[model samples]
Target: MAKQTIQLQLSGMSCAGCAKSIEKALGGVQGVTTVNVNFANEVAAVEGDKLNSEQLVKAVKDAGYDASVIDHQQPEDDSRERAQQIQFYKFLAAAILSLPLLYTMVGHFSWTENIYVPAWLMNPWVQMALATPVQFIIGWQFYRGSYTALRGGAANMDVLVALGTSAAYFYSVYLAASLGDHAAHQGLYFETSAVLITLILLGKWFEARAKGRSSAAIKQLLNLQPKQAVRERQNGETETVDVAKLQVGDIIHIKPGQQIPADSTVVSGSSAVDESMLTGESVPVDKHEGDDLTGATLNKNGFLKAKVRKLGRDSALAQIVKVVEQAQNSKAPIQRLADRVSAIFVPVVLLIAVVTFLVWAFWLDAGNYGKALEAFVAVLVIACPCALGLATPTSIMAGSGRAAQMGVLFKQSDVLEIAHTITTVVLDKTGTITEGKPKLTDLEIDLKGVNGVTEAQLKQAVKATEQQSEHPLAQAVVQGIEVEALEQINDFNAHEGRGVSAKVTLSEQSHILRIGNIRLMREHDIESDAWSKRKDELEQQGKTAMLISWDNQAVGIIAVADTVRDNANAAISKLQQRGLKVVMLTGDNQRTATAIAKQVGIEYVFAEVLPEHKADKVKELQQQGERVAMVGDGINDAPALATAEVGIAMGTGTDVALETADIALMRADLNSIHDALFVSKKTVRNIRQNLFWAFAYNTLGIPVAAAGLLAPWLAGGAMALSSVSVVLNALRLQRLSLNHRD
Candidate 1:
């Protein structure tokens, strides 16, 4: 059975330990092949045979968390945002309630003896009353989460929290009940439990805010969709309607200063649309008849009546949002190490806490049970699995989201990891390096051998016959030479790799037209020696020359060329400067390929390659130990793209190219390639730094905490800050100097 990925939105996962339990629960389900729970983003992605969303959610519920299927079409769930608000209240309420107990605590310490403490405030009943709500009510989630984790045979950060705080709270209650009101000033630790929970909540609120900012890219993309559109009726009428009610194929009217309602093609009128939000290009693109108009692009001026091409989630904007969301939710390959440690994290901490309590009471500071209990609580409260869980995912989220805003969409997190490692960039010549649209540069006319036939007659015959072929070169000839269409075109035949032959009636006479290269002229038994030198001249100039035969006699030479993009030379130079070898792959002949290659500064060229053999060339490069990133934008480029280390596809490419590419560039230029590689290098480095810090905090803090060098409440503050620092480090990706203008 093939693996099917099922995505679920998760809640109630406090830290990395919670992720481990959810993974274990989901993996136990039948037919589940893999399960990854991203604690940072709160999404669980499971791959399996016949995976059921309801069943997966139930398993998570059984394991003591919440899960639901994620709906991409709808806006982001506001429940988590509401939860963040509630947590702020919890922290605020706990802090306000703990203030009295904290003041009473200052009375017990000799260093703060100068400070005044009221007898009523220091009463045992008053201290118990203040600490009770902070412990049981404000900190209720920790107990509930601990119960769930323990019932499911797992332990989480909540287990650590409940254990540490409960040890302090109940121990204080026992002392107060036995010692009566005298317990208030005699080593009571009610303030320890209340203040610890407040600090933990404070850390959670900050972490939630940082995680919220990390997903700003997705929210920005979703906000682009306009709510309303002006729909044109079939009776040549127009009315404003909700964009959701409009169907595909509906004609829409766009007014000046309004946004393009949805993805459509303009049928009439023209305008300058600012597509900076989608493609990251600051320039406003001009839209005329037959030009594609993407939804949410602002129309600066002019009126346009366009027919809708895609609606709802099928629109270009929606699809980009989906890609970004998926990228953010997916885990990076580097996170496996963190996951392995998280699986065993809480249990080991529990054992270490137990050892610290015994060793402190028996050996370190023998018979001092009160001091030993503090060491036990310190060890339990300080060990943070949350930082270990968030390290890689937070970096992946912020980095991938920022890249998407700059016109580079990383389809998966692993692709972001591997893209920076490409040593060679193999560029497909036609659409990748040069403009795919070909134009007629030269038309050599000669009717010397055939008398009574004007040059216009031969031109009409060639245009009418070429119009029947779908080849880019043939279409270029038809579009390049604008003329009235012929009424009759018959017996049109296309010869693969040679040219096209067709019989057309022109000037009240039926003529056999042969339009192709030297190979086609030979097959027709026509002599080609006359135009051999001219053909080489055109080919050397990076133009495709096709010879025309009129009634078996040589007529003229027609040359077509796809020009190199203006930024091609500069982009290639930058790629080489980044320590990548530049190679050009093309199906064009050797001389034409060489000429185009020289124009773009590419030293190595693979010319005269068939579409089927493109992947083979990529494999050959890989065999030579070169890690190649193939950049292409056609159906023929799919195989080679899939074979490369990373495949980059232009925005104007066919659907096949976009689907096969690892990174899809919204900007139809090579500069976006530089942007993609730059972001990749930056993102990978960010993940490494985050992982190192998260590991170091846990590794070094555990031993110090075990020695009782820190107090319980102080340890709780450090644990909370660890998760916050990791997320803050990841958000630095938003400050990238994309330099897309170059």
Candidate 2:
């Protein structure tokens, strides 16, 4: 059989449940073997022999959500508008009916008693006259929604609400028409039914608004890329073209303050690009000819002509949108429990309600049918699954929001949930734990007749030689130099993977200053014992040594190394205190990795690992029965980041690093990692607490209401109160503080 794959664009997914709905919808299609729907991206990937995308889209549409083939992606604006219109109409109709129903129940004039109004005008027929259309038109959706859930063998909050309120109002109308003046007005529950639907709709409206805001993260990311660009024409002139139309080898002109339309390479001009939106870097990166640029990064200053390399869905912005969407839509481990409960919740609740009515009316011999009916209403009202429906999403929104505020942007709640279980943290040495760039840490000088040269003179020589080199150590030497009279040399030569050499005039005496590694010194035939001794000492101290040669003799040595972040020690200690094992993974030699690891108090170190081997190291840790989290801040770390149980990227790192990570730490501080974990643990705990309260209230409270300890009026009030309490408890997470405890 030939393999088949079908793609569909889906909508109406506010949480993982929606994704599951889409998956179930597609899974029901004939010949479909698997259905994977990413709610975050609103895309579904289906596989099977003879699977049809059109059939899958129709199935999704029948589930009350908009869907179509993947190639016909709906505009975000149009989707939002449709969602808003549906919600607004439902709210408007519910509100319009609720107002009059409320006034009739508790008004200045006694309409039910017929004191201010005539018997015919105040009759039960009149109330039903006004309420029947309201029930069918405004409240029918809830009833239908409940009916659908029941048929699917699932129970949501709607089932409890629809059954409870509808029974009360419908039973009251039957009593009034049959018993006439002897009928009890108290049994007329039309107002309660109308008001219940209104309140629930109000809650749903607020939920929809909050969900719209939460889901906007992906939309905002998508909006970062410009819609169009000025492509350099064949005649050397530029003509504006749609970004979607851009292809490889097309030269585009990007101006200062404009967003780059596609991932490309600079062919001409120089500029500093602000990549904070994508990379979370505060500083603008200097870009010259040949520098690769990403779509969505702003050209902060200057102008550049770049050849378009990757565009459309292949661009970085589009990839980020896709990842974020997938994460948001994917189910977290905890949500599965809710799904199981919902699958059988309605039938179980209905059975309990029927049994309660029979036990009260027949077994217990309550007053009459009215008493049994009251018990039935009480069971339905008090057994609402609002708390169950609210359990996961409220915690997710609060947790993800708090994480974002703490500089940890979780692409999905699943990542936040998994972070709590991480036992071992595998960190890349270059950027995860330490500043990746080399910086001059030590400088040594030895001269006889010249009296020791000033630090300023040594800096001048190193800086002049390194001005033309892009090597990490050379950049460090250049940054460390603090001399006023450093002059640029006309002739400069840089040897790849080695160092640089240049001639400078010192006191009118021409001397060649060559700066590079030990290999560069040997190649230049520079000799000096002092330089070797200094190099050995610095290396023992976990620093890289750069030999400096002057006129065919080694005159000095500059020590350069990637320094560990200031808060690394404290962060490591905190992680250990929390019962987490800290491990270091690095491409550097064992000596350097161990020396740095010892300083930071890490007991385990994986050294000399190439980029390709980092992911394997992460997998090895997992095989040891450890839940691992890999922390990194480079493109090379992308594979490991994706491989780990949880991937954390430093916010100050590259775009590729941030994109690949499950969680992006906004602050570069290692301590934030500790803080993020702390927040996740606390958030998960809060979710459990909220779930407990929600479940405890329904499990215990429903029995009390059915036992007639509470009136129907009181039961309605209590149900609303329980929902509010659960919401307030979830909000408490926002108040949690993550300051240093020790």
Candidate 3:
């Protein structure tokens, strides 16, 4: 049999349970090989041998959901639709029964008090008539869930409540029908059972809504990519193609103010691209020929003619979608514990409800059958594991959302949990601690037979020679040369790792302007005895020296180096204040790394290390029992990122680095690192507080309800209040501001 692949666009999943339901439903289909559904992207990738899309749709429909094929692809299961239907029916039934039940219990109508025709024709029987069907119809999920848990040899809060409340309502109905009117009126608890079910359902609905909002963030992120691109045909005309249909090497014309539809390399033209959506960089970046551009970022000014380098699943936008999707799907450590407990919770609660009923009915001296039924109801109401069921997911959702708002994207909730414990941070030097681009910072001029070379002449000579080279020092030389009327050079040649040499016509003599380091000056035999003294002074001041020699004579010296980020020192200081040791790791020479580290307040520096050595360094730190966080922004830094306790990738870094990182700082600023750590600490604290309230509410509320100090109706109300309190507390994490204050 030949293996085949199918794709479908799905909808209606609101939680992990819904994803599991859809997976199971599709798995049950005959001839289906495998099914993988990503709830975050609402897409399903399916594989099978000779499978029919119609059959998949039918299978999902049988499981109580709607599904449809995408472009004749396999149909996907939509559990949210089914869940909504069930919820709507539950709310409708509860609403219809609650009105009559409440009126009979509290209203002073003459009919409510009538006790004439038959023993069953009383208030208790009327209440039973209104509530019993509602329990079976609207509250059936709790009963079925409880039964499933019991059979699986486990007990949850649902099992206890379902058994307890169901018994109370059924027994009351029996008493109302069998006993005389007075006994039936006193014994029936139809109002208590119905009210409990109604309130619990309301709580569930609210919880579902909250979860829906939190999970929607990934979907919203996906919507940022445009659906179509204007592809330039070979005939020089443009045609719009679906983004999914775009292939590599396709030339795409991006007009001014339009979003780049795919990650591509600019083949022609120039523009300023706004990458704020991807890197959170505040300023727009100038993109010319040979510059790479990412999809979903705005083209701010000028037009760009780009050749698509990556499309479909390979694009940067797609990678981001995958990262966020996986993060949401990955289970937090606390959630795994909750799952373990829930697996056994239902059966234990059932056993407790049974034991409570027997002890009250047969063991106690003053116990009546009616009172025993009330005890059972109290046990079930108090034991419901709804709070436990919601604890981990709610907190994870709130915490991750809060992190995203602060421009920190955690690839997993466990990262947030682990980040708070980090004791040391390993920072990559270039691009992370300092701006990767080199700039000219110092200049010294000395000349023979001339007073001294003017700054304009030095700049003109450097720019004329350096404009043809792509080296960092050459670019710095070009930028430092501020003259606009400098003559363009011809026959420009760059010697790799040395310098740039070009010929410029000056005063009828062909002059060769050479701009490079000392190595390049030596190769040309240009004497630099006096220039060497000035170069040493600049190097001590944390600058790199470049010699400018014209026609075998040294004219000027230009110093260039990577500038440190303005906020690096402050960020490092803040991290130290928070009790974290700041360490710098780099491939640069020890002198350069130490100079940069010292300026940035970093006391620990590991220099001249290769890319492969970074992970070993992290392991060495861990061997000393330090919980370390590695911050880097290069493809070479990926190994250390995976090895560290938490890997923080700078937003301007490569895709490999971002994907390997545990947390991605969307803004490449160092201050965002401080903000991220602060948010993580607060988030963990908030989660603990929420968990405490959830546990405390049950610990205190259960006994009071079981001891009969609180009425069943009041217990139901209190349960709703408890769930609300947890949600509100989790929401408070979003309000924290990380702005620095004096």
Candidate 4:
């Protein structure tokens, strides 16, 4: 059976229990194999065979929530912004009405000395008149949410709020009627109920605003896509069209200082393109014919025409956006504890409140029903489950969002949380530590044979043979040779893992020319002592020397070396300084790998390891009790990347690497590896801080409220502060910096 994944936007999830309810509801649907609902980001991901999105939506609705299928082609809806606005207006109106009731209660305090209280304000009916609207009108959402959760056979933060405030409001009404004509405002607690709702609404408004800021990274990425493109018609005329209309093979024109409309290859013209938006490299890269151009990058100082290679969801920008959204929506393993506790937190709090009321009413203050009412209301108002539910997910959202802005993409929240514990980083030699592109760095020619073969003729012959090979080192040899004219070669053949040989018709005679490693020359029975010494010297200097032989005699040696990336040494030093063991894994021979490793300050080396054996090396590290992180160009390093505790892929790698790896570094710079770890540590630290406050707030507040020392109004204010403080603390991750100096 074929499987499909559907993502939906969710609404009305006030706590982790709501997320669990949606997950459970979707899990019960036919053809639904798996469901994950994230309360922090308000998203649900469902995977199943023969699944209907409508059925999933109906399931969520049946479970007392709202959901809609997300269309990635269109911009994300403004549901969150609208919700925030509505919350702000609710807070505003509640605050406006709450002020008069608050002032009336304050008028009874001796601290308001010399402030004359109006006789009408002191009337119990007047206090009830001001507080009634604040209780039912402005606070109606709590009652609605409470009813929803009750019908679903669950409870949430809303249930607690509604129960606590209604208890005080109704008890105060009973007292007012019992006193009849002598009714006084002194014993009435209407102010507590009214002020509590207003304060909770204020906290909700702040949380909504903070949540909006936490997702700003996705908004910025969505804005990068240009709305229109200049398409070149087949008739040699250009037309301005929507970017969505351009299909594969359609030619598009990009002028200087314009954004490339889509991911394409430059078919003509040369220019410098700024890829900072995609790769976070500030410098503009020079682009020539046949060079790949990414969408949303700016073309600087030249005009270019290109054929679209990818559009819509296939584009690099779209993929980044999708990856980020998934990361934000995913829940880390560390969050499981919080989720489990939150699922039972409200029920536990309600039971505790009941126990508190029973102890005060029947035992401690026997028959003193007013004191019992006060203890019950205070206990319910002070226990905030929302803080516990928001602790981990809010931090993950802010951390993942911030990481994306720095050109690092955490594909999963678990990876973001786990990266902090990686004790060993196994780095791939090519692409991870050094530039993957090899260039000819040195050339040594032997001319003492007196065979009438000049250095120029030998170089031309090597280039002719190397030109036919598709290997990077072979291309380097072809590029390094600068002969104005070359001889025509015939019968070219490539030997895998050894070299290439061809029969070149030079000087009107056929001569076999071979260019490859020493093993290839040895196989051909070509031997030269001088070339052997030169090859050793180049190899020791971290270069791969290809032996060039004419007929059966060694003629010259061409050395190719991959340049080390800038800041590789500094990045390695930083990792080592942090007490992480660094090792280099590569397919190159021991001598070359050791030389490159030495240059980059890496002590441990795993050389001559094939792509398939890379994972074995990682397993070997794990056996030694080390938590390993594998960093590589995600393509060839898939096995090792998958085996390690954390897999970090370079964004410059292939699609397979990006899809397989847990973390993607947009910049090729090795410094990003260190930065990723830095951010991970900071994010985890922030999560711990949020959890501590969440736990401490309830541990301290619940007892004080139950002991009858805390007033219901004060308890409500403390509860609101607890929820808002957790959100504020999580937002601190957005400002996390990896600004350590080298």
Candidate 5:
């Protein structure tokens, strides 16, 4: 049975340990095959054989987190924004309440003692009054989180905060209760707990703001979708309607500078359309009658009446957005180590905090209970699992989002991790390295001694016969045949890779017409004879030369060539510079394949290999220890694409090829190949840098805090900074650019 994937938005995840705890709970559910809970995005992607979304959500709630099913088609209702706003208000309240405690704190320190403190601020009643609300009210979230965590048989950052702050707050409350003792005011540590909460709230507020910018790419894409379109009615009138109301068969009118409403075909008029937002190609593409128009592309000039081919999720833009969203939610393989560490992060920190108090109070300091409490609080607040959790997902989100902006979409986080290791790049010749469209370039005719036949009649038979074949070269021949009338064809047959043949009646007589290579002519007991030399000459020029025959006699030869992309050479040069071996794969004959390969600076070529054998070649290279990345844009390329280590499909490719690919390049040229690989390498590097620092911050920090080197408030602030810094480093990927020559 195929697995079903479900996404859930989670709440109450204060740290990475919370994310891991929820993952374990969901995994215990029967039929759950895979679970990936992203701390940065606050989303859980679960794949199961027969999953119930409600059941999954219940499991999360049981693990101390709240969850609800996510809807892909609907726009987000901005619940995250509302949550951030609520946190901001809480932070403001905490800061305001903690200010008086901070003011009195200066009196405790010797260096700031000269600064006057209000005599009333030192009263025990005043100290308890200022710290109570900040402790129990503004900091209630930590208490609730701690209760839920312990009840669920797990621990998180909340447990530490609640434990440490409550110890200081309740201890100070005991000192305040003894109003008869005047020394109680000096013993009160209320400022420590209150000030710690204030710093933590400030840090969380900054971290939330940075995390918001990491997912900005998806928002930019969502904003690109036009909400409204001009629909043409049957009564010859145009009416503006919501894009959601459009259907597959609807007729839409596109005025100058208006966005195309849906994936449609232009039935009337011509214009230049800017598809830069989708393809990352800055130049405007010319669109004429019968050309396909993608939705969300700007029509630069002229009015067009188009018939919609696809709408909603079936459209190209929606699919691109879906790819990006799925990639951003995926977890990289390196995240497993982080998850394992986070599962026990809080418990380990809690143990260390207890050890610090024992060592400082009983062993080193002997009688100093106050100094031991400070060390214990510092140890509890300094160790952060949030940084480790945000490290990988934040980088993946930013990198994939930036890749999509450059017209490259990684289908999953695993692809982003693996694409940088590709050693061999196999490019399809016909449509990948060269423009998929082949225009008619040269056509020559020699009617031989076939008597009473005009060149036009023979050409008419050629056009009618070639029109039935879907081969690019055959189409080129058909378009080049400028005859006003076409001859009727009978018994037309297409030979895969060789050529096409048919029976045509011309000049009131029936004749056999064939168009193919010299081998096809020889198979039929006919030879190109005089045209053989010309065929070799055309093949030498990277053009496919076809031998046309009538009644077993050579009549003419037509040469069609596919132009190489303008940046093909530059892209190949860049790849070779990076130590990647570039190879060309094509069904075209050796001579033509070699010619095209030479033009693109590729030293290796797989010529005359049929479509079925494409996958075999990729496997053979893989067996030879080559990590292959197959790039193509046709139905024949799908098998090979799926066979390679990384399948890169051009956005202009067929649906089957694109769906089979791991990375989809929106641009129609090979320059995106360089861009995609560049982005992958840079993103992986960024992830590594983030992971290193996140680990180092915790590893080096916990010891210092336990040794009493950091103040409790400073420790709380540092913990928050660690997570924010990792996310900020990941956000730098959004600004990465390879400066493509194209």
Candidate 6:
């Protein structure tokens, strides 16, 4: 079956159990293959064959939740803000109504006996009147949720809240009617029901507010795209239009401080564009004519008119948003364990409450119904599975979202979870540890002490041979030479892990030219004793040295040195400080690799590793019990990257590396590795904290409530506070600064 993925916006989920119920319901659908419901994000992703949107929505509704198909083609809506506002208003009204109930109940105590109070307000019937509206009207959501859960053969936080408040409310009504004339003076719980509901509502409002803040990163990303753009008309007139209206090949004018409306090539002007949003580099990059510009980056200075290359959803900003949203919605491995626990949590809690009530009523108290009823209500209210459900998803959402803001992208949830466990980080020296660009630092020519051929002629021959190869060193030699016309090279050959060779015809005379390392020279039987000394000198200086042999004789040496990145040493030192073993792996010779490693503070260096053997090296590290994270930027590194426990790709690297990597650092900055690890550790820690609170509350509070130490109303308040506390804790990840500045 050809499967398609669809994301559904969900509502009416009260706890982790609610998400589980929705998942089960959707999984039961005929065409559904897989379903993942993220309670924190309130979004469900489903993959299936010939899936019907209506059928999916019906299944969710049947499971007692509301679901709607999300149209990803449109800009994200602020419906969550509206939901938060409604929840806030409900809380405000509950708070106002609860005041009188508190005063009426507390005022009768000895601590406030001196305060004058109306006798009518003190009456049990009058108190019931004030609480009835609060319990039935303002708190209707709980009852509706509980009923839905019951109909779906499940239970959630709503079941707990509804059961607890109803017991108190109905128990008070029974007391008032049975006691008759003595009801005014007897103990009543009319205010208990009202106060509990109000407090819970207030906590929910706070939680909703905190959840909004957790997703603020996404909103900020969406806001980066300008709504309108000024398009330069063919007649020299400018027309303002929506960004969506601009198509490929359309010319748009960008001014200083204005966001580039579309991904385009600078065809006319030059300026500095701040790509910190995408690349995480704080420095603004200089742009000139013919340079590629990404959408949503700010034009810091000068004016530019460019032709749009990618528009609307195809733009880089839109793709980043989509990737981040998918990551947030995706489930991490830890979350799967939490979901497994939550699927059975509510039923177990219900059974516990039943057993607690039975023991108190029949065994302990021998029909002390009041004490038994209190324990039952307390047990039900204090047990909240919502906190457990929220532990991983919320933190993942916030962490991944914040990472995106910092220009690091975790393409999948597993990456964020796995990055924290990397024990060793193996860095590729060429593009990863040092700047990938290598210049032709030195070029020497030897005509065997037989003068007549100038150095310029030798350079032309080298450049012609280098042009046939795509290696970085070859490009450096080709660029460094000053040749107007290159003679045709026939029988060109490229040796894997060696270099290039070809037959050049200059002045109607043909000679074989081989440009490569010493190994290639030895295989060709070219004598290079003098050139070998020069190569060793260059290699000791951290420069790659290659020999050019012509017709079975060594001619000269070509050396190129790649500059180390500015933050290479600092990043490596930081990783080592964090207790991670850092190793440098490259194809450079031992001398050159050692020199570069020493400059970058790398303790371990593996040189002369061929492309195909890279994966084997990673395996060898794994055999030593090291959880290796391979960092590379070339297509040849793809196998090693896939073999490692974690693969980090530089954003400016090749597409193959990015596609294979688990983590993509948008810029060449090496510090992002430390930052990503830091964020991952923090996020995982936050999840653990949330889980502790969730599990701890139930583990401790259930027993205390069952022992009658906690009143049902107080248990209700604690339950609300427990869920709210977990959400607020997860929200802390949103403010986590990866820069680690004191």
Question: In order, how many clashes per candidate?
Answer: 0, 3, 9, 0, 0, 0
Model 2: per-residue Cα lDDT over 260-371, one tens digit each: 9889999999999987676433568899999889888899989999998877666656655544444444556776786677556556878998998888888786657767
Pairs of residues clashing in candidate 5: none
Better of 1 and 2 by lDDT: 1
Better of 2 and 5 by TM-score: 5
Q: Which pairs of residues clash in candidate 2, taking residues 3 or more apart in a chain or in different chains?
A: 40-325, 41-325, 407-666
Stretches of model 4 off by over 4 angstroms after superposition? 1-3, 107-110, 113-115, 122-133, 441-471, 474-534, 546-558, 653-657
- Error in Å for residue 34 of model 3: 15
Candidate 6 has which clashing residue pairs, if any? none
Candidate 4 lDDT by residue in tens digits, 22-77: 88889998988878787777889888898899999999898878999988688668
Q: What overall lDDT goes with each candidate model?
A: 0.86, 0.70, 0.70, 0.83, 0.85, 0.83
lDDT of 3: 0.70
The order by descending TM-score is 1, 5, 6, 4, 3, 2
The estimated TM-scores of all candidates read: 0.92, 0.72, 0.73, 0.88, 0.91, 0.90
Ten-residue stretch with the least lDDT total in model 1: 650-659
Among these predictions, the greatest TM-score belongs to 1
lDDT of 6 by residue, 1-742 (tens): 6678788989888788888789889999988998988888788999899989999999999877788888745867667777778888877887777777677766647888788777777777887888888899999999989998888787788888887788888988998889854665666777778888887887777777776777677778888888899998989899999988988999999999999888999999999999888876778999899988988899998899899998766778777876787778888887877887877877888889889989999999977777788888889888877778878888988999888877778877878888889899999998888888899999988886633345677677788888888877788888877775357678989876778898877677777888888788888888889887889999999999998887878888899998999989988998998899999999889999999999989989889988889899999999999999998883669899899988888765112125687887777878888888888888889988998888888899989998989987788788878878888888888887755821
The weakest ten consecutive residues by lDDT in model 2 span 113-122
The deviation in Å at residue 450 for candidate 3 is: 31
Worst 10 residues of 6 by lDDT: 650-659
Ranked by TM-score, the better of candidates 4 and 6 is 6
